[model samples]
Each structure stands twice: as C-alpha cells, then as structure tokens.
Target: MNDILIQNTTAFFEKSFGSVPQKVVLSPGRINIIGEHIDYNDGYVLPAAIDKIICFAFEKNDSKKSKIIAIDLNEEFEIDLTQEVKLSKVVWTNYIRGVIKQLQDNGFSFEGFNCVFSSNIPVGSGLSSSAALECGMIYGIKELFNLDIQKLDISLLGQKAEHWVGINCGIMDQFSSVHGLENKVIKLDCNTLEYEYHNADFKDYSLILMDSNVKHSLFTSEYNTRRIECEEGLAIIKAEFPEIKSFRDCSEEQVLNLKNKMSEKVFSRVHFVVKEINRVVKACEALDQGNIEVLGQLLFETHYGLSQEYEVSCEELDMLVNTAKDDDAIIGSRLMGGGFGGCTINLIKKGHENDIKSKFSNLYLDTFGIELKFYDVKISNGTTLL
Candidate 1:
C-alpha cells in the first residue's frame, strides 16, 4: 500500500470504527483499444487494466451495520443490512447499496463492515471507474470472509449489482477489472465468458488516454436503445437463419442475404457490430504478427465507423482522432468508451510522448476551448489484495 493512503485510511478507520481495517484490496480501470459496444453482442474486445485503480481498506464489524466513507470524495454513506434501500437515486451510496442487495439476493450472509474507499481513477471518463470500485468491494469481502467464489462468478454478481443500480451496462467493465493480466490484452468472448490473452508488444510505442472533459449522462439511455436495435437486427437475421446465435455467429454473406429484412437503422447498427467484430479479429492477428502499423490502421478505420455508423463519436473525440491522424508518429487513436463523450485511446511512439501530448493539448484547446487530460498507461495486473 502507498504510505500516505494507508496512513490516512488508518486514521479514518480508527476514528470511525475504533479500529483499523484487517484487509485492503485494489481493482484497476480498463481501456479498450478498438472494439466498443460489442460486448453485449457476444463479440470480441481487447482490453487491459491501466495503472489507475480503486482501493478499499475494510474490516468486518461486530455490529450489524455497514458504514462506508469515500476518502477522496469526502462523503459518508451508510446502510443497515436489515433495511432495504430503494435504487432510484444517483447518489454515491448507490454503488455500495447495489453490492449489498446483490449479495443478499445471492443468499450470502451479511454482517457489519467498515470500509474506506478511495481511487486514483477519474469518474465519468469512460475508464470503468464504477466497475473498479465494485470489483474491489467484492474482492475485499470475499477475502475478509473466506468466500471461495471464482473471479468470473464475482464479475457476474457485480453485473447484477450494476443492473439493480439502474445503469444498464454489459459485462466488459467488470470482466476486465477482475481478469486483466499484466502486459497483455484479454480478448473477451462476452457470451461464453471465456477469454484469451494476447501479448501486445509495442517496443517503440505507448498507450495514451486523452480525456475530452464532456460528461456522458445520456449514455445509459443511448446504450439501451442501441442494444435494442442490435437485438432487433438479430431478430430479423434469426427469423431467416435460425442457426445464427449472435452477430458474432453471422458472416458478411449472412448479413447481406438478410439486408432487405432489416430496417435501415437496424442495418446500420448491425453493420458496425459485424465489422467491429471482424476488426477485433484482424487486430488480434496484427498484434500477433508484430504488425503495429496494421493494427494502427484498423484503429483509424474503427474510429470512422464509430463516428459515422455507430453514431457514438462526439466532436471532442473526432477532433482528437483527427489530430492524432495528422501526426506521423501516432500509430492509432479511437474513442474508448460507450458514447457521446469520453477519452480517446491512442498508440504513439514512446519517444514522442511529450511531443504527442503537447500537440494534442494545444489542438484540443484551440479547437474546443477545453484542456485535455492525458494518461500514458501500461497494461497492468488486475484486482489483488494489497
């Protein structure tokens, strides 16, 4: 543990519970390089954990009451295990409340716990900060109570918790937080929960995340509507070809054969899903063959699809990707999150890190009148006890 975080958390716990925590857990946020909005379609995704993470210091309390203090946010939230809390509000307590409800629903015995939560990850930046917090909570509770559940099981449970909290998200966020490996990207099969890690070697390059500073409050509603469109597309395709399981199970020819049956809007949605899946496959091959240039071009093409076909890219994201493309040292850049506004994940030459940062920052400010936040990240290990 970092000495400052431990010392502050110790003081807070001592003041609140009269004792220090018995265990601490860390869960990291993840960034997807290319594939987006495909997790629910049972498609492929390449994601890895970054250095930014959420940390929790916790102890089992003797009294049957749960108290949580967010050290960084300087807010306190408490809930009693005996009482049921409704989930309509967007308060900070919703996250903890969701976990408690899901655990109770799963028939797990609950007792009082005192926890101090803090994170270095930025909220609403499309970096999976919410999932990191939930993953850390689940890990801390399991370890503190000697629960032997598998990590993937924990992920599913976490997903249910998020669903109850009113955020209709897919499994990608929680899955990455629980299973991310160091120096590698996990290719997730959203349907089977089966995954394979590919060693992505960029000897001369670095991964940079550029925050657009625009919040995605409408992301939830937009996400659900897009998912429904995808299901509609699937419904049309399945009516003709019952053997096709998901968009993942369909081919270009299969989709083209049923083109007339799909509404134009539904067709556009399916077009992106099918092509994004193929992009993920080809991107994986490019990484395997040590062809960073090919992977870079795939990222560019993916951004264009997102900006046009998926209709998720915003002005800030488009500006960032376009600025990145103008630079010769930058290999690739694309929006990293669900929709309207978030960070752009970029692959750039390591030696030009400062140059890339300065150029993008200046361009973003001149164009959008907003400063850009950049993170030079590496693939790091996932959740663990600290």
Candidate 2:
C-alpha cells in the first residue's frame, strides 16, 4: 500500500468507528495513457490503475441505515434501509446511493453500514476518481456484509451506479477499477466487454501525468454529443455496411465511401474514431514488442486528431502536448479524459523525470501562466478488501 493510503486508511477507521475496522478496501484511479474517447466506439483502451486510490474503512451497522462519509469532500450522507432517495443534487453521496440501488436491483440483501472514504486521487483530473470511490464502497460493503460478489460483477454494478447517477460513462472506468493488475494495462473491447490484461513494461521508462488545471465544464454535454455523432455516423455506415457492428468494425475505406453522407464536422469526428481504433490495434502490437517510440508516436497522433478533428482538446491541452512533442526522452503525450481540460499522459525515460517535470513546468507557466501538477504514477492493483 502507498504511504498516504496507509495513513488515510488508518486514520479513517480510527476517526469514524473509534476502532480498527474489520477490513479496508482499496480501489484505484485509472490513467488512460492512450485511447481517449474510444471506449464508447467499441475500440480497445490501454488503462492502468495508478497507486493513487480511494481507501475505505467500514463496519456493518445494526440498524438499517447505510452511513457514508467523504473525508476529502467533507460530506456525510445517510439512507434508510426500506427506501432509496434520489436527490436533486449530484454529490459524493449519490455514488453510495447508486451502489445501494444497484445491489437492491440485483436482489441482494444489504443492511446499513458505516463507511469512511478518503483518497489522494485528485478529483476532476480524469483519473476516474468517481469510479474509484464507487468501487471502494462496493468492496467494503461486500466484505462487511460477507456478500459473495465476483470482481467482474462488482465492476458492472459500479457502472450501473454511474449510469444511475446521470453520467452515462462506459464500462472502462469500472472495469479498470476492478480488474487492474500491477504494472499492466487493460486492453478492453468496449462492445463485447471482453478484455485482455497486458503489461506496459517500458524499461527504464515511466508514465507522467501533467494536470492542466483547466477544468472541463463541457465534459458532460460534449461527451453526450460526441456519442450521438458517433451513433449517427454508425447509422450512415450501417446503411451500406450492414455487417458493421460498431465504429471498430468499419475500415477507413468504408468511412470514406460514406463520407458524403456525413457533415464535415461529423466526418471529422468519424475520422478520429476510425483512426483511434486503428491506433489501439497498433498500440497493442507496440506494447507486446515493448516499442516505446512507436507507442509515443501513436499518442501524439491521437492528441492531434483529438485537437483538430474531434475538437475536444483545448489550448492548454494542445500546448502541453506540443511542448512535449520534440523531446527525445518523451515518447508519447496525449490529453486524457473528456477533454477541454485534465492531464496529458506522457511516457518518459525514468532517468529524465526531473528534467521533463522542470521543462514542462516552465513551459506551461510561461505559456499559460498556470502551474501544472505532475503525478508520477505507477501501475498498481485494482479493488480488493484488506
């Protein structure tokens, strides 16, 4: 366990329950070093669970009330066992509520429990903090209640909770939260939900996350719009290519043939989706061969397409990506998450960590006048009760 996580876990149980809990649960935040906006396309994504995670302390309560406290957010919520309340505001509490609702929907018997959640995962960094929190809660409840839930089942349950809470996210976040392994990236097929676990062992290399600090307000709205455009594009392609199951099934030639049917804007969106699908395939090949150069180049290409074609990247994202473009020590850099803001994932030489951080920090400060936070992340295990 990480030091901060250990400290937080120890303190959470001591403060909340006045004693050490029977168990602790950990669910990690994920970094999609590549494959942004491709999860919904039914394409492959390379995501790893970082050491940063949400740690929870819990114990079953005698009463039929589930009590949850968010130490970091300074919020507490309670729900009666007999009824579920849907709140108008979407706060940290809804995440817990969603989990309860999902379990109830599945006909699982659950009683009230006291859970205290604390995490070092930076919220709104596109690191899947929400998923981490949800998964942690699920793990804690499962352990405290002695519920026999499989990891995959728990992951799907968490996804349902997110959907219930108004964010129509794909299964990637939840999948990674549950299935993540140390020093590995999950290559998930969003359509079939079939996934293969692979190692991203860039020897003498590390992944650096550069937080742009430019909060993405349009993530919710634009995310839905992008999905709609992809569906529309799918319809256009399906008219000719009836065999096409998803954007992943269509080739560049097929998209070009139906290019006339879509607007330039839609076409651009389709273009990024098509190329991103191909990139994921190639990235897997690169991962197997351990070619950091090829992987880095693909990351740059993805950011470019996301910026110019998909139009999701903002100036800060663009500047951060371009700043790392020419550096030899850096192989790949791309904006992660729903775009507009968040961090760019960079594959850097392990020895050049300070150099890259110093260089990027100065570059970002001079250009955008905003300081960037660099998270030196390591691939870590996913959700588990301790």
Candidate 3:
C-alpha cells in the first residue's frame, strides 16, 4: 500500500521538477488507543502508528530556495532558506516552513530542496496528519543533507514546529509517528519521554475508526482551557501535598480528599486526569495478558471519563458510543481525539466489521443527517526513509 503511494508521489515529483527525487520518506498518522487529554498532564498514553501515511519524495537543489508541491491539495509553494521564515497563509505550507524554522533554530544548515508529497491520512479526523507531514519533511531533509539527527530529535522538532504554528500539541503524535513498531503500541510517559512497546495483536478483532465528520472550531480554545484547569487543579493539590509532582502522583483517594477545597469543575477535571492515568496502567496490563475484552472495557471507561468528567465529548460523540454499545460485535467504542467532534475508535469482531460499520453509518445519518466515515487501520511501523 505504501509502495503505491511512494510510486505515485515519485512520479509527481519527477513530472513537476523534471528529475527523480533522491529520497523518499513515509510518515504515518497515529491513533491513541486508550488515553485522551492526559498527555498534557504528563500522564501516560497508549498510541500506535497506523497504515495511513504521508509520502514525500524530494532532492536537494543547487539554489538556496526550496520548492514544494502538495500533490494531495494541488498546491505549490517556494521558500528561500537564506531568508527569515514566516508563517504562510496557506496552512499546509506552515507545517513545512515550521519544520525548516525549527531545524534552523537547532543549528542545522542545508541547501534548499524541491519535493512533492501526498497523503491518505484523513484530515480533520483527528489522526495527526500534520505531524506526519512535518516529520516526513524533517526526516527527508535529514537524509538528503546527511544531518546527524536521531529519531527522537526528529519527533521533538516536529512537535516544536506544531507549537510554532500555535497548536501547543504534545509529543505523542510525532513520537508514535517516528517510533512505531509493527504489531505494537507505545506506552509513552509524556513527562519523562520514556516509552515501552506493548503487543497490540487483537487476534480476531479489527481496529476501526468511525469519523463523526464534524470538527468544531472550539477544539483549540477548549483544549487550552482544559490545560489551564489541570494546572489550577495541580496547583491546589500541590499546595497541600507538596510531594505530588503531577496528576501521575495523585491517587483516587488523595484527589477525593481535596474535592471540598477545589471548585466543582476543577475537581472533575482533576478526577478525570488522575483516573485516566490509572486506566492506562491497567490497559497496559490487559494488553500484556492478551485480554482484548478487558482492554475494550477500559476503552469504554476512558470514553466515559472523557465525556462526563473531562467534558470534552459532544452529543454526536456520545451518540456514536451509545449506538456501538448496543451491539455485541463492538467490544468497545469511544471518541478518540481532542473531542469536540471526531472519530470513534472501535474494537470489532473481525467477521462483523462490515455489519457494524453499516449499522453505525445508517444510524448516524438517520440521527444527525451526516454520514459516518470509517477507516480500517492496521498497526504499522513509524516514519522511515524508503
């Protein structure tokens, strides 16, 4: 599948520049299996790179100017590496430009490059397509110029680029996109930058993502607000329990004991973060034991916490979960992203995938007049030079 994408991108690059690209890079989008908003709280998250990816074909040019063709969007742009980099009105270019900016800031110098890229990762579906693009560009540049940058550094540069674009995202997306392994999901401790790969072989079950097809503008502001709430909750907890460093350090009992001292909203936010941290630990155990059913149950519980306690889920997201809960084929379902409106990751019995997808699609359209989009994803390796 990725080979086809690379071939197509290479063809496009050659036709656009009249030369074959010297390097081809494939960077995958990621899915968070169980954790949600906890990444910002320095909590653990279980995420894996999916088969969907952005393919890049590029080669260094003689000039100091860089030219890029976005094959998917039918857009093209050029940048002068010697001059100051500025944000572009074209959103996609900002990601590439941001990567260049971060690389320059890190004291890496190189000539400009001409490239063409295409992606199958669904945009606005909360799959981290931007991270794939940024990481792909960074990795491609590193290979093209023979820069001494490690995989982890590539992930960090991609993250810094996103932050430059004003998204303030965490390392999970970029890390998983660059460090994923086949048939494994990474258990990442966001605070410590430590990770462990856990087997994600769902023997007879398939991983499916059902898109809500609605991305609210409220996601950005609301995400920032959630972070503020968590900080406030942490500050309140820290004042009394000075030993506590983050939500990771707090137990359910300790949080409950501080409930009366904090506002209702803050307390609820703190409760979700602390509880979700524990859920990730248990989910890892379930995966180690090869218990998909228990893992599914943990997914459902995480969704509930995101919806009720974290206040991130919307009516459409809740409706999707409710619909899936009625069917035995779907062992678990939940809204999987920043959560105003996005896809719900489901663990469905292999043979019943189509039936469950059909059922969810019809019911969702009937209820909200919007069709649901489904993606059958596989666990695959992270970004790499092909």
RMSD of each: 1.6, 1.4, 0.9
RMSD of 1: 1.6
| Model 3 accuracy (lDDT, Cα) | 0.92
- Once fitted onto the true fold, the runs of candidate 1 whose alpha carbons sit more than 4 angstroms away are 1-11, 88-90
lDDT per residue as tens, model 3, 156-177: 9999999999898888899999
In angstroms, give how far residue 126 of model 3 lies from its true place: 1.1
Please provide, for model 1 over 154-272, each residue's C-alpha lDDT reduced to its tens digit, 9 standing for 90 to 100.
Answer: 88888888888887888999999999888899899888888999997876788888999997566778889898999999999888889988898898788888778888888888988
lDDT of 2 by residue, 1-386 (tens): 46677677668768777877777888899988677888878888878888898888887778998777778778787889798557548477788888888988898887888878788898888899989988888888888888899988888999999988889888889889889999888988888888898877978778889999888688889988998988888888888888988888888988888888999988999989999989988898988998878998999999999999999999999988887888888888999988889889888888999988988889889988999999988898999876
TM-score of each: 0.96, 0.97, 0.98
Ranking 1 against 3 by lDDT, winner = 3
Ranking of candidates on TM-score, top first: 3, 2, 1
Off by over 4 Å in 3: none
